[model samples]
Target: MQSTDVTQRFLFDNADARGQLVSLELAYREVLAKHDYPEPIRALLGEMLAASVLLSTAIKFDGLLILQARSSGPLSTLMVECSSDQELRGIARYADDITGDDLTDLMPDGVLAITIDPDDGQRYQGIVPLEGGTLAGALEGYFANSEQLPTQFRLVADGRVARGFMLQSLPPDRQTDPEQRAATWEHLSILANTLSAEELISLDNQTVLRRLYHEEDIRLFDSGPVIFKCSCSAERSGNAIVSLGREDALALLDERGGEVAVDCQFCNASYRFDRDALEELFEAAEERARGLH
Candidate 1:
């Protein structure tokens, strides 16, 4: 909220549950900087962006955490990506005027999915029904049913900023004192939920921490920085074109004036490739297949 994306982890000295608080500002603004989105769509992006960071708090992954939603309404797609380092990026696609309401109102029957892709492993996905009133409640239900952990989330997005907090219970074996763990989780959840939009978007990370946990023995960990970044490049675009098959690519490129133009839908960045580029891609694909054999 202090003009930056900051992720902080906190532990309760005498409790079995842990928590994380993540706030955003500059990165959130950067997400909307490249295009002119409608007011409602922008706010929806903020909500999804905040929820992604909050979900990443308790996830143990070293690569990417992608949150996506594809709906049937005028607002079609929304996506937010977070890395182990808390770096984040997001964008939304929707009509200019999208009924003007909250997330549930806009996306009534869509599915919210979170994909965790580790540094060197298979990707795992979890789907959550977008039934509840707020995105926060929907994710809380997700944790309870899928992860089997009592989790609480507080997501706040406004003023072109996105932020959230999460409290997760440890494994039962570690939570020998069930009452204490429950008490600690409730204490933190209440404080986190009471956070104001100003506190989430205007104050620094530590200030927010102190304001929320000053009376408790909450231990703070190393701070992680987050930013808005889309991993789109010319090489990736070329690979995608190659996957489309050389004949089709060549035909399309020929129709488009001897060059292929591809746009990265997430960041709205354009990549252009002339005939030579496609030739090179096909050649490389062939060489890779041969080497594999």
Candidate 2:
């Protein structure tokens, strides 16, 4: 079992299907260390993080891919974001008594939203009901309903390691025979279903693929590293405070004993601003406003 974090992309030479395998060890540990999340929430967040990376690899965007789940049960919200550069961050909000193991038990009447935010273009979001027993099932349902494609996902996380595997059918243009395509997809999906949770979290990408598809000719591409990185900063946090208007910012500053602090939910990093810093930030914001006018 390698300790490095990586995502590998591969294709079946004999079928019109492509896949991605992601293993997260250090990144998983870093994310878990940021907060004292309960066992179930930690596992859920790990799955969401791995799923975000796996889904992001399928797109050609230059920004972020976010996986968000909101519900009316004990687990209120779970959010994970993975950038095109493979940087990832995630957080979850839940009640103190949340002890459910199944997705429905934790997030009853939940909705899963997948958002693609490109750096240069309009953002796209797809929403679907979280209907499956597990996170992987909900994601597969999303692909079937929204993308009109057959997709399969297997995700496992035990607080120490998080791993995910995704297999998606290619577009119709890629295959001439529809029956053959369907057969190939079913065959590969059945083989993938045989993967155990322990193997997914413990084995390397090459060994996993070989064990799953030993009879097939698969083309494995270069692997990319996945890192745990929070995009929050003092400047961004200050801008957020500036959005609250001058009077409100000043009131917060005064309430906090001359310093306002903003804590990032993902990484728990604190950004503080004193009265002088707030004044300077507001002055610069006003200057930008005047320039716009």
How far out, in Å, is residue 271 in model 2? 1.0
What are the lDDT scores of the predictions, listed in order? Answer: 0.81, 0.91
Across residues 124-165, which tens digit of lDDT does each residue of candidate 1 receive?
Answer: 999987778677788888899998888887777764677787
Worst 10 residues of 2 by lDDT: 172-181
Error of 1 at 158 (Å): 1.6
Cα deviation in Å at residue 199, candidate 2? 1.7
Q: lDDT by residue for model 2 over 1-293, one digit each (tens)?
A: 55479999999887789999999989989999998998888888999999999999977799999999999899999999999999999999998888788688899899999999999999999998888678899999988988888999999999988999999998865567988778878899999999999998888889999999999999999998999999999999999999999999899888889999999999999999999999999999999999998
Best by TM-score: 2
Name the lDDT of candidate 2: 0.91
